[model samples]
Target: MNRKLWAALFLAGLAAPFLIYPVFVMQLLCFALFACAFNLLIGYTGLLSFGHAAFFGGAAYVTGYLVKNAGLTPELGVIVGTLAAGLMGYIFGILTIRRQGIYFAMITLALAQVIYFIALKAPFTGGEDGLQDVPRGMFLGLVDLGHTYHVAGKPLELNLYYFVFIIFCIGFWIIHRAIHSPFGQILKAIRENEPRAISLGYKVERLKLLAFVISASLAGTAGATKSLVFQLASLTDVSWHTSGEVVLMTLLGGLGTVLGPVVGAFTVVALQAELSAFGSWVTVVIGVTFVVCVLSFRRGFVGEVLEKIRTRPPGQND
Candidate 1:
């Protein structure tokens, strides 16, 4: 929980590509950041958003288009996508803040569906074909991200792993700053007791709006990066299923813990990959995982385990 421990963990991430498959690790990092950003609203602000795919899939399309046909760099594309998501969040938040719980979720889901339809019809997005062959391009006009590495000093293709890794670090740092800031404390207080916080002169609605926009922006960042990673963006990115996937990630990882979503993302993504050969069994497995986690791992995989260690007797380590 100390600064050093967190720093060490980040260092571990930075060094992960050396020991593990870079592409897989990068995917994990991106989803982890997505889950963390989603957690900011649901876990800390106590607002469960059911339409997050709007931000995630929308940004992916935007960035995919920009990178593929517009000749924009990856960084610029990500920024544009994040801004788009923030704008959508602002509009949606303004319309939905008055309603809480199921109403708010419904509003978001409906609005997201609207965006999904737009993506479906948008010419730039390529509709069902998707924006394909997206260039990861050069990083800062120096590092040619279109190339990769090798075990015996050879230039391999698919440098996207490193590109995604860098983006993931930036996203993680931004969320860390937000959650550990003074504003974050007020959001937490609102989560604990909204009426009391409002009575204490805090604008609960505004806080929630800010959190929502922040979450959307960060989710957009992840989505945009993902598009460039896989060299494509399609309807699958913005579908309701993706929204559910992120929710499952946050739930399995431990909502309030920064590292929980990372673990959750890796677990879910890996499971999906490994079970792809099983067809319908994949859905059944994912559903079963969600049910088990909800019924059993209430505090999440990391949250309960970490809490237990913290409460352990002297000289115990976890």
Candidate 2:
């Protein structure tokens, strides 16, 4: 949260395109945003949702359909997609709020499965093929997102990457602000002891529902942006595997800490990209890594490191 750290991260993002593929970086940003959204729920509110892919993939489909079929602008499509996911989250939260623990998780999983089936059967989703060739329309019907600009005599796809980066920054800021707000403090209290939160006269269910909606909406924003980046919306986005992946990213990064999800997402995505040729073995390796991290560093890679630094004895070497 230091200004210097923020400046350093911004500089790194600005320079990343020159060192790595812009598309890959964009993908990492989208997933990072997604994982952050997931963290807002489970990390802060103690809500373990197992069907978040519903919101993520559902928004992708909605935004893709809007861009490809409705001829909407990319920004507008993303907005509608995000709102749709929020509404879905609201309804799902209403249904699941009365439940607790595993029951709550099961209800979410069940709801997401229902959505997955609908996507599979719906004509607009293209079934197994998904919605393809999604156009990255102009930003606000003015700036062409597809257009590239020359940076140092080399054509750089800075347009869309910058757009995605801006969206990511906004989303990240919103989450950070929320985590520091009084509402977020209440959420933490709820997480630590729901009975105590209730005894304190907080409308625990309402706060949780709001948190759920916000989480889903932001997650949808990530998915919508990702659809634009990939120019496709498919079943892969909606699958249960994706739900598990987000959970893994949150856990690997550090559950309650800001920036943990971002680091986790980058780590997981980079591993997948690097080991893609290994096919299913990549999953095995990731699984092993997750287990090792859990066993040795339960606070997660970043979380554990930060905890150690904070708890270290005075004058001890870091």
Candidate 3:
């Protein structure tokens, strides 16, 4: 939340491509943004959505289809994809916003299943194989996203990585602004005590609905950017597994904290990449990690750290 931390993160991101694979970093950024979007609804708004993958994967499919088949530019395709996801979120929120707690979560899960079935049958989705070979296309009819750049005497394919990073930063800034705005306060009020917010004359349902739509739109933006990075949109993106993954990222990072999702996303993504060779064992390891984190660090990695810092004795130095 401080300028110093922001500067440090920016510098780390700038130097990451040189230290690690660009594509991997791009994936981390995408998932980080997605988790932040999810956190907006569940962490701040107290809305537990179980079907977030619908927006994320749906947007990926849409952007991939538009870029590959509809001949749309990369940026335009991503924008349309994000908007489509927001529209879907609006409809879903209308249907489920009245429900509370587990019921709301279940309804969202059901809706996501419906969307999943639609994707399975839709011709554009290519059934199980999903939309493949999605072209990254040129950025704004200029800057070829598929191009590579040389840095430090080594060739780094950073064009797409930088593009995704810029998009992530924009999305992060928007989310940060929203979280600190008056509207965000109302959402938090609704989250803390909906009846009180309603008693105070807040349109609780409307606020929740708006928060839901914004969260979905941002998630969709992440998915769309991911599709460009990988040149593919698959069922894996929309599967229930992905929905769970996003939840895990948010929980691991610390819900309600701005940078929690980023930390969680990086950790989960890095673990998966590192354990790729282990195949099914990777899931076991992640499961164990999740259980440990939940039991030992309930506030999440970043959340717990921040809490310690805030609750530390005055004049005590780390």
> lDDT for every model?
0.85, 0.94, 0.93
Which is the winner by TM-score between candidate 1 and candidate 3? 3
Name the best candidate (by lDDT): 2
Q: Which stretches of candidate 1 lie over 4 Å from their true place?
A: 153-159, 313-318
Model 2: per-residue Cα lDDT over 206-242, one tens digit each: 9999999999999999999999999999999998999
Candidate 3 ranges with C-alpha deviation above 4 Å = 152-154, 315-318
Q: Which candidate model has the greater TM-score, 1 or 2?
A: 2
- True-structure RMSD for candidate 2: 2.1
Q: Which stretches of candidate 2 lie over 4 Å from their true place?
A: 150-155, 313-318
| Candidate structures ordered by lDDT, highest first | 2, 3, 1
| lDDT string, candidate 3, 60-176, tens digits | 999999999988989999899899999999999999999999999899999998888888998779999999899888989898988888887877777777888899999999999
Distance from true location, Cα of 291 in model 2, Å: 0.7
Q: If ranked by TM-score, best first, what sequence of candidates would result?
A: 3, 2, 1
Q: What is the TM-score of each candidate against the true structure?
A: 0.93, 0.96, 0.97
Q: Is candidate 1 or candidate 2 better by lDDT?
A: 2
For candidate 3, list the clashing residue pairs, or say none.
Answer: none
Going through the candidates in the order shown, the clash numbers are: 0, 0, 0
